[model samples]
Target chain A: MEAFKETLLSSFIVFENQLNGQKKSELHKLRQKAFEAFEKYGFPTRKDEDWKYTNLKPIIKHDYKIFHPKEQKLQLDEARKYFLSETDTYRIVFVDGYYASWLSLTTHHQYDICTFSALINRYPEIADEYVGKLINHGDSFTALNTAFAREGAYIFVPDNKIVDKPIEILHFTTPHALPAFQQPRSLLVLGKNSRATVIERHISLSANPVFTNSATEVFLHTGAILDHYKIQTDHYEASLIDNTVYQLQGYSVLNLTTASLGGKFVRNNPIVKLIESMAEAHLWGLTKIDSSELADHHTSIEHIAPHCQSNELYKGIFGGRSTGIFNGKVYVAPHAQKTNAFQQNNNIVLSDKATVNTKPQLEIFANDVKCSHGCTVGQMDENAMFYLRQRGIAADKARALLLLAFAGEIVDKIQLPELRQYVKRIFNQKNHIDFDFDL
Target chain B: MLKIKNLHVSVDDTPILKGISLEIKKGEIHAIMGPNGSGKSTLSNVIAGKEDYQITQGTIEFEGKDLLELSAEERAHLGIFLSFQYPVEIPGVSVTNFIKTAINENRKAKGLEPMPAKELLKLIRERMELLNMDKSFLSRSLNEGFSGGEKKRNEIFQLSMLQPKLAILDETDSGLDIDALRIVAKGVNTLRTPENAFLIITHYQRLLEYIVPDFVHVLYNGKIVKTGSKDLALALEEKGYDWIKEEVAI
Candidate 1:
C-alpha cells in the first residue's frame, strides 16, 4: 500500500512538472479541473463495473515518467513502408507524444494542421470547449490521460470543404530506460457540410513493455461525413489502451473501423453518441490474436436523439492459448424514438485451450425501436477440415485456408481498397499464410 | 492387384466382418452384394485404413504392399480411392483447389512435380464435363449446398481426376437419380483399364447393368456365402437376399 501511494504521488508530481511552463490559459484551467478529478478518483479498482474484467494494478504499480518534448528524430523511410500504397494523404508524425514537424508532410495552404501543443497555445477557445468533455472522468485511465496529455494532433476540416485525400497521423514511440508512458491525444472536428478520411496508426520501435494511453475524440457537425480508421499493430511486448468517442450531430454519418493484429495486452473502448436527429454511426473491428496475447474490445452506442441508427460488428480469431473478450452495449434513451440499432460479436477459437468471452447487450428504454444483439463462440468446422484434408491439402495448410476464409467476411467489408489490401497483407504476414486469391 | 485374406474386423469390440476373404486381379471389377448388417461398408472402410475399425485377424495387400501398415493419406498416395457414400461438405475451399491438392500430393508422393495450374484446370474441366457437372461448380465450395445427385456426380468426377488404380465405390448409387447414376457409371466405365480394378459395394443389381462386374459375391453374416457370374445378380434381384440365406443354410 505504501508503494502504491508513492507511485501515485510521483505520477502526480510528474503531471505537475509537465504543466508548469504553460501560461495562465483556458486549456490549463481544463487540465487543472481534470487533475482535480484524477486526484479524487485516483485509479479504478477491479470492483468498478467497467474494470471488472480488466485489472490495471500492474499498470498503476510502476512509476512511469511522462514523455516530454524531445529533439530526437525517427527513421521515416522505414515507417512509410507500412502505409497504404495508393492513397494520397498528408502525413503527420508524432514521436513520443510530441508532434515532430520535420517528419510531417506540408499541409495545403487552405487547410490547417496543428499539433495539440500548438492548439493549446494558439486556439484556446476550441481546446477549452472540447478537451476532457467526451472523456469519462470516472475511468482512471481516461482521467490520467487527461491530467497529463502534453501533445498530440489537432485536425479541423473547414465548413463546406472536401478533403479529397486522407490525413495520416503516425504515432511512433521510442523505448526509454524507465517504464515509459505516452498519452497521445487527437481531436478531429469536422465542420458542417464537410467530408474527410483520417487514418491514425500507433507503432512502437522496441519490444520493451511500454504503456500507450491514447484517446481520439471526433465531432462531426451537421451533414458532415467522417471515415476514421485506427490501426494498432505494435510490438508484441507493448500494452495499449485506446479510448475513442464519436459525437454526431444532425444527419451526419460516421464510419469507424479498428484493426488490432499485434500486442501483448490491448483494450479498445469505442463510444458513439448520436446527439441529434437522423444521425447514423457504423463501427466495425477485426482482430487476430495468437501466442498468449490478450485483446479486449468494449463498445457502446448511445442514441440520445430521435430517428437515429447505429450498427456494429466485431470479429476475432484466437489461436495458441490466446484469450479474447468482447462486450458491446447499445443504449436507446427514453426519448430517442424510432431508433434502429444492431450489434454482433463473433469469435473463432482455433486451439482447444484458446478461450473467448463475448457479451452483446441492448438496453432500450424507448417504446418504439428496433434493437438486436448477437454473440457466438465456436471452433472451425470439423467437417470442413476433413473435406479439405480428404482433398489432399496438408492439415496445417487446410486449417490456414479455413482461417483466412473465416476472417475474409469482415476484411472484405472494408470499402477502402488500399486499406483493405494493407490489412490483408498484415493478416497474411501475421499468419504466415498467403491468400493468393483476390477477396 | 488387390487381396484380402481371413479379414476379421471389429468396431468397438463388436465383430463386424468375420473371416472374410476376397481377391481381384488387375482389370477386374468385383461386386459385394449384401444385406444391411452384412458389413459391406465396413469392408471398404477397413481396406482404406479408417481409424476406428480394428482388424483382429486379416491381411490386406494392394499392389504387393501391406495396406494396413499405411496411413489413410499414405494409402491414398498408393492409388487407393473410396467414393464416399455420404460426401462431406467443405465451405470456402473450391472444388478445383481441392482436386489439385489431391493430385499434387499423390504426384509428390510418387517423386513427381505438382501439376501446373493451367493443366490441372483443363483436366478438371474435362472430367467435370464427363460427369455432367456444371463448370461453375468447380469454383464453388466443395460439396457445400450441393444436391444429392450433384454430390454423387462430384465423387465420380474426383475419381476420374485422381485416376486411382483401385477404386472402391461404397454405395455410390444410393442417393443418385437415374440420369445421375448413368453419368456416374459412365465416368467409372471410362476410367477402366487393364491395369486397374474396382470393388463395388451395393445391395441392388441395377448399377451392375451399367458397369458389369466379372465376379458377384453374396456377403451374408459378414462372410461370402456365394460367388457367381453376372447371372447371380439377376437371380438375387428376382428372389431377394432371403433366398441366398436359405440356400446357404440348406
Candidate 2:
C-alpha cells in the first residue's frame, strides 16, 4: 500500500512539473483533491464491507508504472477486431491510456463523440459541469482513477436528436518498457428526447499485467433513452476496476447490460440514482469466471423519487476454483411511494473448488413501495443435465449448453444486432462451446 | 426387435420389477395395461436406460446387442425411444432448438453430418403438422409453462420426429382430452412403419380404440401374468384389474 501511494504521489509530482500550469491549473487542483482522498483511504482490505469478498492487496503490490505513449502511432488494423470493425459506428479508441485520434472514427456530425482529453482541454468549463460529480468520494480506487484521469470517451447527445448508430469505445492497453497502469475516465451527457446506444469495451493487446482504474459518469436528461453494453472480456493477465454511475431524470430510461467473461480479477461498481419520478432503469450482468479468477459486481439502485421503478438481474458461472461475488442493494427513500424494485442474482458453481457469494440487499422506507430481492448460489440443475443428455448431448456439451443458457439470458438483452452476434461468439469461445448456434 | 428375458429391476435397492419377460417384433403394436404402482413406467424407464433403475438380474437384447451395456443416449442412438411419463422442462432452450439438437446428435452418432438447415426445417414443419402443433410452439422454451395436454402433444411430436425402431409410449394418453388423444394417437399411427414397432403402455382402453393393438398383456405384481389378443385390454377395462389380481393370487 505504501509503495502504491508513494509511486502515485511521485508520479503526480513529475506530472505537475511537466504541466505548463496556467491552463491546466483546474485539472491540477482536481488531481490534488483526488490524491488526498486516495491517501486517506489507501487500498481497501478484506475488512471493508464492500470489499469483503474482494481483496486487492495482491494486485496493489505490483510495481505498475503510469503510461504515456508518444503520439497517435498505432493503426486501426491493430485494434480492428476489438471494436466495431465491420459496422459503421461512432468510435473512440485509446491505446495505453492515450487517445488515438488517427485510429478513431469519432464524429460531431449530429452530436459530439470525441475524446475526454480534447474536451477537457478545449472546453474545461462544459466538461467540468459533469466530470467527477456523480461518483462517490470514499472508494480508494475510484479516487485514484480520478487523480490520474486523462483520456477516454466523451459523448454528448443533443436534445430531441436520435443518433442512428451506436458508439463504441475501446480501451486497449499494452505494456511498453514497463508494465502499464491506466486510468481512463469517460463522461456522457444525453439531452431530453434523445436516444443512443453505447458499447464500452476494455481489451488487452498483449500478455502483460495492465491494471485500469476507470470511471464513467452518465447523465440522462428527461425522456432520454440509452442502451449501454459494457463488455469486459480482457486477457487473463489484465485486471480492471470500473466505476460507472448513472443519474436519471424524469421519464428517462436506461437499459444496461454488462458481460464479464474474462479477466484475472475484476471489480465493477455500477450505481444508479433515479432522481425524478416515473423514470425506469434495468441493470443486467453476466459473469463466467474460471481458472482461479475472481469477478465481483457491486451494484446499487437508489429510488429517490416517487413512481420510479428499477429491475436488476445478475447471473454467474464459476469453475476451476474461480470465485464470484454479487452484492446488489436497492434503496427506496421515505417519500419514494409506489417505487417498484426487483433484484435477482443467480450463480452456478461447476467445480468443487469454485465458490460464489450472492447477496441482495433492499432497504425500503416507503410503506407503499413494492420491493423484492432474490439470490441463489448453487450448482447446475441435475435434472436439466439429465434431460439434455437423454437427447444425446454429451455430458460436457450438456454442461456447456446449460451454462450458456444461464448466461444467454443477459446476452439476449443486448440491443444491437451485430453486437449481439459478436458477443455470443465471444461467449461461446470463452466457455469452450464449439457450436455457433444463435442465442 | 426388443427381447427382455427374466428381467428383475429395482429402484433405490427396492425391487420394482420381479422376473418379467416380454418380446415384441417389428410391425406389431403391443399394449400393456395394469393398475397404478404396477411398475409400468419403471419398465419403460429401465428400457430407456434410466440410471435410477438397477437391473439386478436381467438380459435385454436389442437386435442381438446387449442394451444394458449402453448409456441412455447410446440406447437412443440404437433406435430406442422412450416417451417420458413426465416431460422435463428446459428453460432458455426452445422446442425447435431442442429437437434439432436431438436429431443432429442422433445423426452424428451414426457418422452422418448435420442435416441441412432447409431440410431440417422441412422435416420439422411436416411432423409439426402431423401432430397438429402450432409453429409458435416451436419457439417457446421447452415445456417451461406447458399445460399437461401441451406437454403430451410435444412428446408425441418428438416421437414422430425421431422415428425410432421401437417406440415406448409410457402413459402418453394420460393428460389428453378426447380431441388431443385423437391427435396424439393419429400422430403415432402415421409413424408406424413396417420396420418399426410400438409398445403402448396405458391404462384405459379408450386409446386402444384409436390405434388398435395387435396384442395385449396384463402387467400384474411387477410381471406380465397374462398374454392375449386385443380383447384382453377390453376385458380388463370392463373387469377393472381386480379380477386379474384375484386370479393371479393362486
Predictions' DockQ, in order: 0.36, 0.58
Q: Cα lDDT of model 1 overall?
A: 0.81
The true-versus-predicted C-alpha distance at residue B218 of model 1, in Å, is 5.7
- Name the docking class for model 2: medium
Candidate 2 lDDT over residue span A1-439, tens digit each: 6797789888877776666642355666777788889888888889999989888876777788875656565676777767665468888888888878776788887899998887787768867788888867688887888787777899999999998888999888765655678889889999998999999888877676788888999999999999999888888888999999999999999999988988988988999999999999999998988898889999999999999999999999898989899999899999999999989999888899998988888888999988888988888887677667766776677777777777878888987788788877877787677764664
* TM-scores for the candidates: 0.87, 0.94
| Candidate models: Cα lDDT each | 0.81, 0.86
Candidate 2 local Cα displacement, residue A352, angstroms: 2.3
lDDT of 1 by residue, B115-230 (tens): 88889878987887788787899788878899988888888888899898899998999887788889989999999999999999999988999999999999998899999999
Q: How close is candidate 2 to the true structure, as a TM-score?
A: 0.94
Give the runs in model 1 whose Cα sits over 4 Å from its true position.
A1-9, A17-23, A57-63, A68-73, A106-114, A159-162, A192-194, B1-26, B30-72, B100-114, B199-206, B215-250
Predicted structure with the largest TM-score when compared to the true one:
2
